[model samples]
Target chain A: MKNLQIFCVIGSLFVLTACRKRLDSFLFNNDNSIIEYKLDSYGGELALDIPIDYLVPNNDIHLFEYQIEDEGEDLNISAIFVGDLNKISSDTVILYCHGNKDHMDHYWPRQKLLSHLGEQGRFGVLMFDYPGYGLSEGEPTEQNMYESTNGAMKWLKNNGLSDDRLVIYGYSLGSAPATKSVGDQSFVLSPSKLILEAPFASSSVMVQDASILNMPASYFVNTKIENAEQIKKCEVPFYWLHGINDDFLSIESHGRTVYKNHSESWKQKNEVPGANHSDVPTFMGLEVYSDSILSFITK
Target chain B: MVLVVGISACGPAKFVEPLKKFENAIAIDVGGPMVTIPDVASMPIPFSSITYGHGWSDKLTLHGSWYTTAAIFGVAQIGAGATYGVWKSKRQKHGISAMLGFNTAFDVYEKNFKFWPQLDAHYYFKYNYKGEQQEDLLTKNGRKRSNLLYVGVGTWYELEGVKAHGEKQQDIVVPMLNIGHDLNWKKWTLKTEVKLIAPFSSNENIVLDYVSLTGDKGSTGVYLGLIRKF
Candidate 1:
């Protein structure tokens, strides 16, 4: 283990020293985005296996791609729409804003549970690619990702998904977009509610104080996205979902700080004791999160 | 509690397609079975493409490809400029040739490693021509070979999960160029070529081999495949 750790440090140095910048597109490791595939028929993270009927050779969920044309290289975005408008009406559209590490394809299982929740809530769903992600255009930045996600909101409206019943669901890095995206262009924001699962206090905090950020999360991170500051200005009900055991973004530091920023006028705060930073959907299940969303939207 | 900080920073050299009902032709020799296979399932629906650049004067052809099992993502390379030809009139052949062609590619080659341009060499040799309409004396025993190469760059781009000085990074400068060849005979084809790769021009350790404990520049990975294009 000691040798492995040493090698890891050496490898990290090489990764930094070898190329002047990002890996070429032709290279597999030079990736900053993802492809999100949904397994909506199930309720939680457990039943991820594709049902035989859905996999009956030649029949499967199709992928829809959209490219965001932004002048800034840091603003290119790609997105995939998983749920069918004809089959389910989620009544509350769940706009899934994902994290930083993996691509959209990495979260299909989690979204599948949300899809299942849509079946229960009678609402539709819309998930898009972040700029610098998967097929989306632009380089990545909190501002660019935020704008791209805002554009997705407009896309959802234009594609028949309205904002009156819209629910902003932010996960990990996605929290930045949801917070920063309150009133941007093409954003229909009379939102039903906002659900931030395992959200960080801010992007800078996630970098400075979070476990993922070893160097004081503050030393190296220059981009500052303060979701805690924006939540207070939101017009709709804002809901916070946190996995108390999260090792990456501490709930007390990031989540609580943001929650405390509400000035007592905000909607509600909910927590699942065991769910880690990213384990909110997988460990807690759609029923729990979906129910909280439904209760807030209905009331 | 020691946390891992991964910060990736690179240069401007590296920057970073599609599918179709590919009407293709091929020669199967080195990739799978030497002799003719029984049918489709016995063969690999190898979806690959190549290109020619610098006109006929440079003799510099570049190319690259990845034929998916088609069990994932989607299926069938569908579009124009898609071809599968056999090289040489023998059961198997390998050589070099030049031509002009248009293609649609689903893969890319990273060009520029620090300051060193990289290349990806590919090899293809067809051993069988399995088509319904074209089963002539050549179908009995003929081969093909070809090479395709492409090169280009990225303007505004980046990468994710890369470590730089013990930290993670999300973007980079990406540029690349590719070249490939196509040799056809009877119903077989052989393809080969190299791609120049370069990543961000600033940092110099993008291509480190820690396992070998050496600092090596980027390289040209060789791809060899075989299929019976129908």
Candidate 2:
């Protein structure tokens, strides 16, 4: 039995090693050599037409798209600034980081909503795509995403954006970089204002908890994702959001552990009654969610 | 060794109505010598050599083979065999079939892995080798090695995806044992073979073709091929 257990452990390790290599090879090399990206499909030579439906934040809002203040190569990042610029009485900037998959185009609606809060808009909103995402070059990695986000804050500082004007907001998978980028500080802009939406506790936990996979025991997998505990050091306003019916990544994991860590956390969670990952925006009613943002930013 | 078992009554004087009817028939379907498998005439079958075969107790084996590509293949004769089955599959005249058993048979039994620069004329026969190991195969058996020749029609097995090479041959290792349909075509015999251990890289079930005369590798590789009789 001991030998069998040892074998299982060793085999799982090899499997994981192979999987990581496969992922790396797939990302870097043309091992499966064939280009799928159609140059024509991604905004080719067509004359630029500033989207008519482009987001326009309320009176106090000011959108600024700036590059991170970095000299390093390939760390390019751009922001989708939102919120009321004039009413940003608070010096804090909310860097609303997004998840993998898709681009800024799909989230224009959320951009519009952020603009809805006249005074909220004043608290600058910054978000950029990692390499290989949106218009960014190269590919995204957990390590680089953190580096990229840190550079953004550095840019903000060089350009008069301060720690007081820095609030990190990560949604779903983006929560990792958001929580990690916060470093060791509190008050305002430091991972200070964490709003994790339907977050995954860890990749290992997700793999183990998945229903479609032949997941091994939790103890067998070792991935580092200490979100809730790590955030305990955060001495700032933290909020948790999880739809009631989150079919993917279950709200149980994203919600319970997140809210459980706080002695006085300003937490707001619900199943959204009958909502899934995709419909969270509609079920929660944008206006109500938008008001919460206004109150938080103003506060 | 092929075992020829004749079910008959043992007696000097046989009954008027013999239990076994000796059937001797010759079938020659030569319609104006309708084009033989292309490239066959141009193939080279060096030398027709015959080597001695030996057995093993698992440690080793004895292999033997004789080939002739002659002027057709620029090969006068080539004979090689290992104590262990060299790894190969073939068919010859006279209905006798047997796989040089593993651990105790000839090692050079497999025709593949030979690494010979010469090519062999092949007489391929495959049909009802049991199961639906059928059509959807287009191959051209005529390259030297690692190179591609032409593409043909039909198939021996379902391994016809390669752009070149005839099939896997464990010539350097143990020759493969063969078990498949009898693609019996006149005096010229075409055959397919199988190996107990195939390379770990391949995802397809593979087999090799043994042309009685001269033939080379196919562009489709061993996945598919063609053979003709003289």
Candidate 3:
């Protein structure tokens, strides 16, 4: 019995040491600045310019830097709005949530493709860096993710965008906040529609899928991004687009499961063949992907 | 504590059996398994194991153990082994053992099944106290009481089937140090063990999609259990 007591004390110490905030699995990079590129003088050569102007031609790109209070600390958040700012009041805006990766610079091309969806410049696109990604401050966590997303939504709402005209598109890791925003019920207004691209089912499922082992995420991580359960409470039109060949989040286990769990009457799923986790837009071709998104929103 | 950690790896609690020879005895034990996370402290999950042993002769014993835990996930494992006594002295004994086992685990959310086969080889030493050196360490009531310490080196091999990544099987080889203490009184015995398992050989980084399982190289674990002998 005395030996057991000693063992318990030793075990408690191990618990204290092992139980810290585990964030590396979620956030990949800590670099703050966006990558810069210069265009060639020749017109035929396309170059990615700094401040991302070359990506969206004819559209005015407005950069907004804001701060939100999280856990009593101020976090710096960066957002990019494409198309005319005045059009925000009258035109529908798509809130683009990108996947887990480096930062916003890596997603400029995807955002550009979204802006061209349904008639050139017909709809505006809003995208921002989550905390610890790109130029955003603070660590990436479930609570922080919600706070950052809500901050972005509030910013858009304050700047003439209304709930009826707002569309939420979550790609990969961004799907956590996107699905959560609708299911939370605390948000002032729900978006017009929700889009999930190659979205995973939940954090636990992701851990199991990643480790190829039957283990719960709660054992290692506290983040619970339960999209399947959260989507059941959402009533808005849901659009799920997944690469049939997606190796990261399989369509059968994640995307298709979320789509099936959503009881919303207005829901659609597009399984792009020959596309993997990262190259959905490229595989479907920008034109077809844009048109398909345009049709989903307009319908 | 140790049982739980062992379950996390889909294996039996690495408890060192008693070095002293026994004639026609059966024992059962239950305890926790613990595992160490680098930089972070060692964590113990709730796990338990039941073991049965039969002595064939003064120098040979056959044993089987089944372990499981459901604290964070479900894990089930069954193992069978043979222990052979190599040397014995007034206050010391040495033994060698080999075990073969299989385990299956599943998570609540992921709903994926993982199956694995494991093999283990160990060489162990036991040191008995002054009172334990007597031929009969039992009381007038036929109750036995003694303190025994064990130390060992072991090698474990496992082929784990991870169903999440298209049924990919990962090969894990862990060389470990095992230390334990056994206290017996009457028909009840309490056993505690601590094992330190070195990380896998490859740097491929076992990415299960959200977490890396093999990133932490040196893992420390503990197991504690109560056994009943009849």
Candidate 4:
């Protein structure tokens, strides 16, 4: 019995160690690679109707790469900023954190729609690829995600943007960095307001959804990006948007929990009907979606 | 995070045929629902359980099981059940059994737990049985050999009034259907089973990619068990 007990303990430890997966690999589907971001030229599935004037030439679209340290190694992070760089100091900027899809090329049209938020180029919208995404170098870790978003914020700050004028918006997986930037005290800059679309509550919620039970997230994943808890510390005016029909992360389990947990003073919620995970913008119609965000920014 | 939780009670039927009075058996089972891992082929999640059964009478057996997989994941899960033989042939070639059971899981993380009440019934047919203890059928172990094939239907009730994050729990009762074969070698039995879990529950909207033959509903589970009879 003693020998059997020892074997059982060792076997349990081995199983525990082997079963855990770094959820970033599964959560972030950053598989596609591109030599250049062919924004309008590359026809992707999801698109919004933007006026021809709002295209690349009319907007000051800057495609640049910034450097960040990932575990002591220097990695290049790719970014795209829309609107006039010269007016960044005076303009309110929205940093668009894209979801866990392929790359920025797939999200270019969405950011283009944001560029026309209040009026064409009224607010500079900046979006970047997380590490191992698109043209960015190094593997995509949860730490690297926060660091990359911080790197983008630092770049915007270097170009004369301030916290009060910075608006951080995250969708789906991007909610991790966006919530962290505002909620985490150690973060470089806290944005004036926070916006999340179809945000998942936490890794544990995902595990619960998968199991339909209160199974611990540590069983299968080590990523502890709990946006629900983070939103409690976020005192900024919060804007929560979710699709009623979000199948990947249920609105009730993922989005509503995050929205409800925000103990902050000012908050707004938009529960769109007939919208899935990635189609909230298109489902709400481009003009309506853009106008809704404008109202939040001005509020 | 597609950890297969719905297959939490998956193991061989506690007893296809109840043992004679005072007999006992211990079993170890492993396997679970199939899930398609991203960039990897579909496979079973390998949930495991250890069960012990004791015969109280010729017609009834009591059983309990510890969920080894859940324990490994830091969740304590256990189940208890009783099987009553409803009918049996004079030659012991066929039998019918009914079982009632419950499995509960508790996690220390948030002090959260859940209970599922279960009911199952099985019909079994025994074949190629040798009466003598010295008879060797498939192996050289000098043990009486027999084979039992059983088909069963079961359902587990979700007792929680609310789902994760206060969502009204819609699926209260999940149904399952299973078919299994047990090879008996006197004091040893090897069991293999295939189950259709939640045959009517929609697989859509869940993060895991379940390989279900029931169109868009339900998932298939596979299990293997070894039993030592005393």
Better of 3 and 4 by DockQ: 4
**What lDDT score belongs to each candidate, Candidate 1 first?**
0.43, 0.37, 0.62, 0.81
Tell me how far the alpha carbon of residue A124 in candidate 3 is from the true structure, in angstroms, after superposition.
Answer: 0.6
Per-residue lDDT tens digits for candidate 4, residues B61-107, read 99988777766655667789999999998877889999998987665
Candidate 3 has what TM-score?
Answer: 0.60
Stretches > 4 Å off in candidate 3 = A1-30, A33-55, A210-214, B1-230
Off by over 4 Å in 1: A1-62, A72-76, A86-91, A118-121, A183-190, A207-219, A264-266, A282-286, B1-230
DockQ top scorer: 4
Docking class of 1: incorrect
Query: Which candidate order results from sorting by TM-score in descending order?
Result: 4, 3, 1, 2
Better of 2 and 4 by lDDT: 4
- Clashes per model (N, Cα, C within 3 A): 142, 98, 18, 0
The local lDDT score (0 to 100) that residue A84 gets in candidate 3 is 82
Instruction: Give the CAPRI class of candidate 3.
Output: incorrect
Task: Please give the ranking of all candidate structures by lDDT, highest first, separated by commas.
Answer: 4, 3, 1, 2
Clashes of 1: 142
Select the stronger candidate by TM-score from 3 and 4: 4
Candidate 3, residues B67-164, lDDT tens digits: the string is 43332232223456666655556444555555445444433333545454555555555444444456364443334555556666655444544423
Q: Residue-wise lDDT of candidate 3 within A28-82, one digit each (tens)?
A: 4334554331111222211122223425654467778778889999998888888
lDDT of 2 at A213: 16
